[model samples]
Target: MSMPTLSAQEISSGRVVLRKAHDADRSGIIELFTDPVVRTYLGGPRPRRDVESHLDTSGIENATAKPGSYVIARNGTDRLIGTLMLARRPADRPGHVTDDRDELELSYTLRREEWGAGLAFEAAMAALRAAAAELPDQPILVVTQTANQRSLALSDRLGFRHVCVFEEFGAQQSLSVARLHSFAS
Candidate 1:
């Protein structure tokens, strides 16, 4: 079976905009991933050399072409402060709102400097709106480390309720869901 493709979408929420990653965002995304504190809950920060090399290859174009993957920019600037990803959860994965493999999974990461400024929530809310518009009736799932209080709180504020908590990647992972609306189409 072939994978379905999602149409690219752009959303704006005041000074923050959710749009596709551009070539200019390549360096910023690399910087976002390489920050030690930013990657703490994530596996870990990748080596600068490795990240740079990946960007030099196919990272930018691939990211841009994929739908539901966005670079969060501020004030219409090319400087990306974070990223949002909405993807289908792998059927093999532990968390699932249903038996379907196409459930939408929401993930995001922002620069440390943007922390406590509510930028992550802004960007994510925009992405959620777009997801609701495109994939209505389908629930959005956010999986994060339970120990990451900020992320957990953000998920809660975004109206995502805890579905379950389990250990994954040697850390406690919280699987949350938000069923914003139902699409009748």
Candidate 2:
């Protein structure tokens, strides 16, 4: 079965569109993840096969089986400029078993040329707003490498408070979590 492509509203800046990713977007998505700067923060380049496999796994056809995730900052021509993923922890996981619906993890990336333009911040805020409307009681969490000042700053500007710093993938990193209740209200 094919996944449905969801259309997201334009953020205040109006330069970006957060929408469901299509299987055809696999190549673009792979480029976004493969950029050296992006890899610096995201860990490293995913093996080509791994990226291919994940794109297949994340195809829109699987929407009903998973939390909402999307390609962010799609241009007017529908080119993917960035990506955002929002998902509740799996029900079988320890965290989800306690509070499944009220919390979600957020991950995003944008082309280097798009950085410093506030597009990432705009997209993230818009996503949070959408999530708040769709899941009013849920909170959003953003985890990133401590060295990723760009993302960390964006998170802070968007109201994500610092929660902790820990090691992930064998590297010391910062973990920030935010509650969306205030934004919703």
Candidate 3:
């Protein structure tokens, strides 16, 4: 099912605005996905050539039409810093917390230069707020590599409780969940 587009202003925090990705953001997206430091926890960086080829062909419209996908950009300059998504966990995936087996999952990544400034946290909270509005009582999940300290810490800060640990892609993954009540605050 297709998701609605979010109003950038409605979900913005102090410095970050959550909105759809644009053609102009391709370069930034390419940069974020190709940076070794940024991709360290999410899987190693993709080849620059590969990223270029994909962006050059598939484009941003396909990526933005999905319900909860967003670009985390600076408010005034509108500089792309990261991406955030609250999507359904595939029924076939390892983490299944609800009977439907399609629980919402929160995923985010910030450019390396944007790290240490809380943009990820701010953008994530904004995205979760938007998700809570649509999903109401449904819980949102996040799966991160156990070794990704930054993401683990962010999940804790966002009030996601650890559900379980399982292996995926040859690495230990921590599946965490945050209920609607947690987002109420």
Candidate 4:
């Protein structure tokens, strides 16, 4: 299904709201990629200058132009604290649940300050439930570095069972999946 049908209100629940990103979010967006704490398991933080350069070229305004990319924000504010993205896992990537590649993938990252509050869990659950309700039953994958115990735990909390572990990015990466139908309303 297309992204247009999924509105910010649809994925929003309780204290958190997931909405498309914008230029006003430049610093927050940059922080997600540059903050050492947030990027520890994601290949480390990129240089801030390079990140700014890329964002300038791509235009943060164009980010939400695609489907399933959201800024994780508090319910009463527009300030962005993190990002939750659902996108196609390219066929050429190291992980896959089906013989065919390009399965739906869920990835999220929150600012350091938001850790331990269960905000990531809350935002992710809301987004996945929304996706499950709107899309057909299929395997949705969550691939994370095996060394990331927190992420592995979160995957389990989200009902994804580990299927296999493979080498990627010079480290062992675990692939887990949850059936989309199981989450449908």
Model 1, runs deviating above 4 Å: 1-6, 182-185
Worst 10-residue lDDT window, candidate 2: 1-10
- Report the lDDT of model 2 for residue 27: 70
lDDT (tens digit, per residue) of candidate 2 on 3-28: 22213433333677777666666677
In terms of lDDT, which candidate is strongest?
4
lDDT of 1 by residue, 13-79 (tens): 8778877877888778888879899999999899999888888887786765676678888966657
Give the range where candidate 3 is weakest over 10 consecutive residues by summed lDDT.
1-10
TM-score to true structure, per model? 0.90, 0.76, 0.91, 0.92
lDDT of 1: 0.79
Residue-level lDDT tens digits of model 4 in 1-185: 22232344336788888987778899998998999988999999999999999889999966566678788988888688888888788788889977778688989998998888888899988888888788777788999999998889888998999999999989999999998777765
lDDT of each: 0.79, 0.67, 0.82, 0.84
Candidate order by lDDT, decreasing, is 4, 3, 1, 2
Candidate 3, residues 1-185, lDDT tens digits: the string is: 52333334336778998887888898899898899998887789999999888877888765566777888899989999998887778888798788778777889989888888888999888777766665557778899999999999999998899999999988999999988646754
Going through the candidates in the order shown, the clash numbers are: 0, 3, 0, 0
- Candidate 1: residue 99 Cα off by (Å): 1.7
3 versus 4: better lDDT goes to: 4
